[model samples]
Target chain A: GAGVSQSPSNKVTEKGKDVELRCDPISGHTALYWYRQSLGQGLEFLIYFQGNSAPDKSGLPSDRFSAERTGGSVSTLTIQRTQQEDSAVYLCASSLAQLAGGNEQYFGPGTRLTVT
Target chain B: AQSVTQLDSQVPVFEEAPVELRCNYSSSVSVYLFWYVQYPNQGLQLLLKYLSGSTLVESINGFEAEFNKSQTSFHLRKPSVHISDTAEYFCAVTRNAGGTSYGKLTFGQGTILTVHP
Candidate 1:
């Protein structure tokens, strides 16, 4: 089975420009996650979506960061008016569900976003 | 709220020698523990996990972690290491019971394991 996949392995954009990173979770995966890895923060959880709607979005750093999942598979993370600080590797992961006992997330090769 | 504490930010060891990466989490409740390895320029990969049944879990690559409830720790250990083991290792935990939390992974600062030959 194919693991999670992300688009535009590397993205370089001007500051203040909006960028959208896409993620394709494994087929039949019911849950998707978006995370950011920065030099300062290490690895931070951005959001989690079950099917379509996100349940916990507290990890989103600011209003400029937003994400959505559609058709219960593909998820896009949008960064509006990207700042220099927004330059980081945006990672996506998926799993069957967020269950406690036996569910493990499968990660995708992160999309490295560089705001120039 | 839950948090992960990886005491050592880096661990350098000689090839073919034993190694241990310490990880401690705040919560003692029923939780899922995992160790992830991030190779250079690659996504984080699941090294191993300790969910239930066994206090000791082992990865096919000779990596193992013991779930110590009394210590609130899940330290990853490998009796022997190779240069290929050079990468960032993350310790994560989630407070999930009966399918909850959306499998949100709270990772530590990460430990850079450098195996020098």
Candidate 2:
């Protein structure tokens, strides 16, 4: 089975421009997650979606960041007016579901976003 | 809230040598611990985890981690490592608050493991 996949392996954008990163979860995966890997912050959870429930947007750093999962399989993270701080690798992951203890998450190669 | 600390930012060792990457976490609530490794030009992969019962867990690749409740640590260790073990290692934790927290992982500042031939 194919692991998770992300689009535009690398993206260089001008500051203040908008960029959209896409993620395709594994087939039949019910839980999806977005995380940001930055040199200063390490890895931080950005957002999560599970089935038809409301997406958890708590980890989103600012209003400029938002994500949506459509039809329970694909997700898109949008950053409006990107800043230099937003330059990092955005990783996507998926799991079967949130089990009692925890579920192993399969990660994608990630899209490296560089804001100039 | 939970926080993780990976004591060593980088570790360099010769092939077939023993190595240890220390990780400590703080949380008021019970949590699950995990070790993830990212090879160069690759995505993160689960190395191992400790959820309950046993305090020690091992990965197929000879890496092992011990969950020390009193010490609040989940340090990863390898008796003998291969050059292929070179990669960035992350220790993460999530609250055991069941489905409410959605298993949001709080990661440590990763440790870059460099194995020299």
Candidate 3:
């Protein structure tokens, strides 16, 4: 693909319902990341996937938040029993490879999740 | 863990004026620095980064940032501001350690730049 792409650009869900956000990283990119941008806050790292496996899930806020990547391509972020505080912009990014320190990540057009 | 700090939350300036957004980082080990910009209702775009080399880095859009290792700062600056420059700017850092790495980035609370005409 041209760049990282995310599905459901905008999603409004009621409290207590579950929601899923998806991301398709750039082709052949080996590293993928998830972040949450709350109103008036910085980008909060959620999880990082190295191909089909996730090695750094340290940033996941809680047990309700979980993510998985399949076939080293698409990723899904699931929020069980969504809460009002979950309203934020969900962002996805991918990098070519982690070497010699770091690689610049290309970002997706983020999904704006609104829980009421 | 590494952390970034953006001093000001919001900065309002008149068009054609110079601007500087301050950022500081903390890390126990060597790390790469970066500045990202987010436009209205858009995803963040990498403006510039300081992986290694000269302390100075630039963007095509006339914005520049300097990585000061001694001070642990990577401040973004521009000589002149335009209305189109209004956006949210973020400073980020990632570890340069050796290990099974996924390149997780730690970001600062963004600074919102408002350019007045």
Candidate 4:
């Protein structure tokens, strides 16, 4: 892909329902990241995946928020028992390399999830 | 702990007027600084970055920012604003903590730039 791509550009669900967001990063990129943006707020770091090493899940807000990246290409973010507070835009980004000094992440369109 | 702050949540300027969006970070370690812009309903796009070079960096679209180490600030500035530039701007930082920090980046609260005609 020329740039990162996300699925279900917008998702509206009931309070107790579960919602899944997907991200397809640029091919051959070695690093993937997940972030959430509340309405009129800044980007909140969620998780990060680099190659096949252990993912950094320190940013997951709660136990209900979880994500996984498969084969180091595609990633999914799942929210179990979504709450009204979960309504926000979920973004995914990937970088060509994992090094901190030379990595500029490319972001996807983002999935706007609204829990009614 | 590293945190970035955009002091002004919203900035409004007339088209062709000068504008500046302030960003400051608190960190005990050296970090990389970045600026990203987001149009309405669009994803964030990188504007420019400060890794290692001259204290000032310029973007292709007439936007520039200067990295101030002592003040811990990376403020973005534009001499002339365009209506098309009305969007949200974010400041981010990436710290190099060796093994613990690989590709993770922290961002500020973002400033909404509204360029009125």
Best candidate according to TM-score: 2
Using TM-score as the yardstick, the better of models 2 and 3 is 2
Per-candidate TM-score against the hidden true structure: 0.96, 0.98, 0.96, 0.95
Model 3 off-target regions past 4 Å?
none
Which runs in model 1 stand beyond 4 Å of their true positions? none
**Poorly placed runs, candidate 4 (over 4 Å):** none
Expressed as tens digits, the lDDT of each residue in A18-113 for candidate 4 is 899999999999888989999665688898888654468888989999888888788889999999988999999998776554488999999999
lDDT by residue (A1-116, candidate 3, tens digit) is 48999999999999999999999999999889999989766689999888888988998988999999999999999999999999999999998877654788999999999999
* Comparison by TM-score, 1 against 4, better one: 1
Q: How well is each residue in B14-95 modelled by candidate 1, as lDDT tens digits?
A: 9999999999998745778999999998889999998878899999999999999888899999999999999999999987
- Best of the two (2, 4) by DockQ: 2
Candidate 2 lDDT, tens digit per residue, A1-116?
89999998999999999999999999999999999999999999998889745447788999999888889898999999999999999999999888653888899999999999
Better of 2 and 4 by lDDT: 2
Model-by-model DockQ, in order: 0.71, 0.73, 0.69, 0.65
Most DockQ-accurate candidate: 2
Task: Give the runs in model 2 whose Cα sits over 4 Å from its true position.
Answer: none
Give one digit per residue, the lDDT tens place, for model 2 in B1-117.
899999999999999999999999999999999999999999999999998999999999999999999999999999998999999999999888776868788999999999999
Full-model lDDT for every candidate? 0.91, 0.94, 0.92, 0.90
Candidate 3, DockQ to 2 decimals? 0.69
Model 1: DockQ score: 0.71
Q: Considering lDDT, where higher is better, how would the candidates rank from best to worst?
A: 2, 3, 1, 4
Mind giving the per-residue lDDT tens digits that candidate 4 earns over B1-117?
789999999999999999999999998888889999999988999999998989999999999999999999999999999999999999999886655567577899989999999
lDDT of 3 at B14: 97
